[model samples]
Target: MPVRAVVVFLNLLLLFFLGPSMAWASNGPAEPPRPALTVSVQQVDFVEMERILSATGNIRPWQDASVSVQTTGLRLKAVFADVGDVVQAGQLLAEFDDTIIRTEIDQTRAAIIQAQASLEQATQNAKRIRRLMGSGAVSQQEADQILAAEKINQAQLASAQAALLGQEQRLAYTRLLAPYDGVVSAKSAILGAVYSPGQELFHLIVQNKLQWEASVSSRHLSELETGTKAILHVGEGVVEGTVRQQSPALNEQTRQAIVYVDLVPSPLVKAGMFVRGDFKLGTREVIVLPRQALVLRDGFYYVFVLEENNRVALRKIDIGQSLPDGVEVLSGLVAGDTIVVKGARFLEDGDTVRVAQVAADTVPGMASVTASGAAFARAGQ
Candidate 1:
């Protein structure tokens, strides 16, 4: 072969081999395509939100009284009321055996009658003594003695009258009367059972009016006051109530205080029923987002915030009161910040996402997105 042709052939062979190697070296390995996550986002904004304090407690009568006997050593003769029975003030609830009391009263009346007779006799005797003393037929000492006897009989008559009054009062105590309009909650008095003074016979709930005694944390005490409005959850219904009072001291163990809320009359409420309620403290401007937007991981709360170029940043936030519409964002968020509402659970920090919708329209399963990147566009509108 010619020398020039050989050189050209060698060069062509080297070019074929080196050309492929050089192209491979210049271009690094191909990158995998980034996964796109479909998400719905909403812009955080300041909304009119009310600060409410939630608490749980029991329903109890506004006024409860233990009815007991005032007079001692009387047998319960009859019970006019039983548990759950309604009663009125001054109405008879039970009766004690007043036979002994009546006899005592009769005896006192008889003693008064006898003392009156003696007093009248003594008066006549004193008149005669005075007449005789004026005529000098009786000695001054004898007349004075007769007049003293008359005074003694008159004092005896006064004592008898007072005794009769006490007996009469005791007789009246045998009939148990209701102190107020209330319902009988309990009964321990049995027919023919002897009872003593101060022994409870019946339990009465005044007016059947109930109050919710809720335990609230001490931190929220300053936000509550008497006459503050409250909503009580009783059974399947809600009843309006008012904050009537609160305990001055906190519980030693729980460090919580008792708040009493007087409920308006409702058939659903009764004494001893467990209830939950919320106190409406007041309204304030707050940055809020939908509950679905929040993602709870470990022990903290987080939200996926949208950034430039379809990227998301996981943000930790301090949550405040949870309302019906959304949750109050206490911190870690600002007004007009776009946050992922739906499909945030499947995301991680700094993940690239394709926003399916924005604002109210951004809700999961929604069909469209707005031009302003609204996650809750319908909500804002």
Candidate 2:
């Protein structure tokens, strides 16, 4: 009896240690157990999205005209335009003292008159001398001297007339006129300061036109072209613009090119204001997933791809442009791949997940599932 009891106890100990192994071997490997955290799964889809390039730039005038004096040595008498004043083409912006110019012009005109009278007298003398040249009534040397005097007087008249015209033009320069319709951005003209030739008096924003000069990377130069649409973020509002031109050469130091975008004149925008812009290259089809699906690990982006048997596998993906709707997956994912959108942070590689809802077109009750997933995401957050 004692031997039988000891055998029964040993049998019970063996069963306790090896019974579960025997059962597991008979049933084959048991399926993976699900995690406690419930998650939402979504299938990636190819959606048409606007491809945009983001860049920062400055606002400037479409045409900046420097208003300067063409003539010199005149005292500024009056300034009719100030900074921020709008003037039309041919409108007088300032005036110089015309007293000296007019006096010089008058002197030149008088000199011309004297020269003309002397030239007439010389012509008559030369004619008489030519008539007497062969008759010996006048010496050859005397006739030659008469002809030379006539030529000299004619040259003097021409010089004097040219001087008179120059003086007249200088007189006109005393009245400074707006070269075109523009808003005066800067003014340097004083009430009595004498201006020198080519001295800048005012800076004009031609036609009050503004433009955005964006410095973009040279890599994207091929994508941007003339007439490309861009949106600018201005103060408290947004402005639409069109690409007008691109720099022919890249900056040697920065490897950046200047993209000139013409902007409609707006009160909120001003020259030299730094702003942000988005260039719309065009539309393209790309696979996109919601932001919640992305997980950052060790500075790289990853997503939890749902596999068969409700198991999740960690996948590293390359990302591109990020939009309000979702993030663009450049690689490591494809359409029809199911990814964990919520509770991704709670998962590990090969973790079995309880998908409370699946977001897909073919799935029935998709609206309800999406709503529930949104609520679950909110709760998880």
Candidate 3:
């Protein structure tokens, strides 16, 4: 072949092979496409939270009283009080049959009247005897006898008066009265049932006062003090209480002490109710994130943090209290760090994500991130 023709063909072949590669060198590599998953972001923020210690306990009355009668061998005529009734101190609760007691009182009163009359007559006779002794109309021995009879009459009158007072007290015992203002907790007196002395007929919760007695481990006892605030879970609601006292000694077997919390009066609270409560020890400032932002994988908690270029970086976080507001982030996060709140479970470390604007009404203490609606739609698809 001719030299000129061969040179031309080699140049053409080189151009053909290297043309596309040379053109690609003029432009940078194509930008990477955004990830398809859509996610809402929330900024970590500081929240003032209360330090709480949880404990379980039961509700009980602060003071209990057993109402009974001192008189024995009496049949109950009427029971005016029943369980769950609120009564004032000295309120009539029941009555015993007082027919025999009233009769005895009347007879003693009659005897006292007779004794008083006889004593009056003896006093007049003693005065006459003194006058007669001076006139020699009566001997010294007879005068002494007359004075002694007057003394005997005075002693008899005193005895009759004492009997009358005893009968009156016995009559008063026929009625049972409340010892204090309280709620009736139990009743044992039946209509027409005979009662014995000191036998309990009614049980009362004094002043309707109740306390929550919680068994707290000795380790946490020091953290609590009188007037410490606590909240009790009562049914579907909660009741506030204050630490009124603590047991000085711990249980020998359990090594736990009783913390008595005086609860605010609520109709829902009742003695003998088992309940759970949390004591508010103090407050602290902590970083927290929405619970949905966390992903649990292989027994570990992780979150997808927004990094530069709309990429996500997976971070392992130590979580503390899981509050109703948010999950407390103990470590691996800071104030003002953006994290994926929604759709975090579908992401991996270093994954490019299409950031979507969360609703304007975000969690308290969190800032909202904004993005184009078209990008959000494409990411959703």
Candidate 4:
């Protein structure tokens, strides 16, 4: 009886030791320490996306021409065209004193006549020397000397004629003629005032072809291309333009590239003004999440994702530009993954979450101060 009782006691002790261990082995891994997180998760998707580049810059004339007087120290006899005048090509816009210039021209003509007479006499003398050499009336050495003298005279006559032509051309330049058919944007010369060469007399712009010259941050260069459609903000309307060029050089101050867009012919537009422009590159489909859903920590972005076991895991994500709906995730997540869209700031790693959808639809845009969190708004205040 005693041995049996001892055996019974040992059996009871073994049962007590092994039962707990069997229960522990059946449980497997321990439950994670997850926080109570409430959020709305979204599935990532791919759709058509159009990249845009926006910047502020000034408008300018495509063919801006500055007209200046080429003749120096000439008295302005009269002014024919004024500012805002639409002139045709070759039209005489202004005149300078021709009194002294005309006299110079006459003198040049007299000099030309005198040179021609000298050249003719030299030619006749040379011909006579050649005939004398053939007939042996003059020695070969003497005929050669006469021919050299005739050539010298001929060179002198040519030099004199060229000077005369130069004087005649100067007389013609005294009259300032319209360089091209353009509107007079500016007029600087005064009546009867003597102006020097290269003095600003007028400013002209070509009749058509206006340009929206904009400087954009170099970071945005990839978003723009030649022939890309752009909208130029005008006074009260938007003008359409096609990007003509994106300069490779960057501005020193702003570190931006100069972009030129040619505007369609518009009656309401003029050059030398300010404007805002936007260019569309192309479209892309990507996974987008709201700016509010992102949790920035240690120079990286993250979003809380719910796993199948009903637990939340901190998911690191690569984010791009802010969009109207949400931020585009460049990587780190795929479609059909549930991300925490709301109450993400209050959650931590290994947090447990209950997924719920909100009635209000949201997209990625700049997060408003009031929308970040109550704590953030208070700190700013």
Best candidate, lDDT: 3
Candidate structures ordered by lDDT, highest first: 3, 2, 1, 4
**Compared with the true structure, what per-residue lDDT tens digits does model 2 show for residues 1-381?**
699999999999999999999998998966667475788776666778889999999998888888889888778889899999999999999988889878888888899999999999999999999888899888999999999999999999999999888888888888889998999999988888987899999999999999999999999989998899999988679899999999899999999999999997778898989999899998998887778789999999999987866789999999999898778999999876778877998788988877775434444212123432332121111
lDDT of 4 by residue, 223-250 (tens): 7778989987777888899989988799
Cα lDDT over the full model 1: 0.84
Question: Whole-model Cα lDDT per candidate?
Answer: 0.84, 0.85, 0.86, 0.75
What residue runs in model 3 are displaced by over 4 Å at the alpha carbon?
A: 1-36, 51-55, 99-172, 215-219, 233-238, 250-256, 276-278, 308-311, 359-381
| Model 2 poorest 10 in a row by lDDT | 372-381
Q: Which runs of model 1 end up more than 4 angstroms from their true locations?
A: 1-33, 126-148, 357-381
Candidate 1: the clashing residue pairs are 41-375, 358-374, 358-375, 359-374, 359-375, 359-376, 359-377, 360-375, 360-376, 360-377
Please give the lDDT score for candidate 3.
0.86
Which of 2 and 3 is ahead in lDDT? 3
Misplaced by over 4 Å in model 4 are 1-39, 54-64, 80-88, 110-164, 181-187, 206-226, 233-237, 245-260, 265-276, 308-311, 353-381
Using TM-score, give the best candidate's number.
2
> Residue 259 CA error for candidate 3 (Å)?
2.4
Residue lDDT tens for model 1, 1-381: 999999999999999889988998889787754746887666667777778889999998899988888888888889899898989999999998899988988888898899999989989999999878878799899899889989999999899899888878878889989999989999998999887789999899999888999999998998899999999887789999999999989999999999999999988888888888889988888887778888999999999888877789999999987788778889999876778877999999989887774333334322245555433442343
User: Root-mean-square deviation of each candidate, in angstroms?
Assistant: 5.1, 5.3, 8.8, 10.3
Q: Evaluate model 2: give its TM-score.
A: 0.84
User: Per-residue CA lDDT of candidate 3, range 1-381, in tens?
Assistant: 999999999999999999999998878688797785877776666767888888998999999999887897878999999999999999999999998888888888898899889899999999999878789888999899889989999999999899889878888888888989999999998898887788999999999999999999999999999999999998899999999999999999999999999989999898999999999999998887778888999999999988877889999999987788677889998876778877898888888887665545444433345553222211111
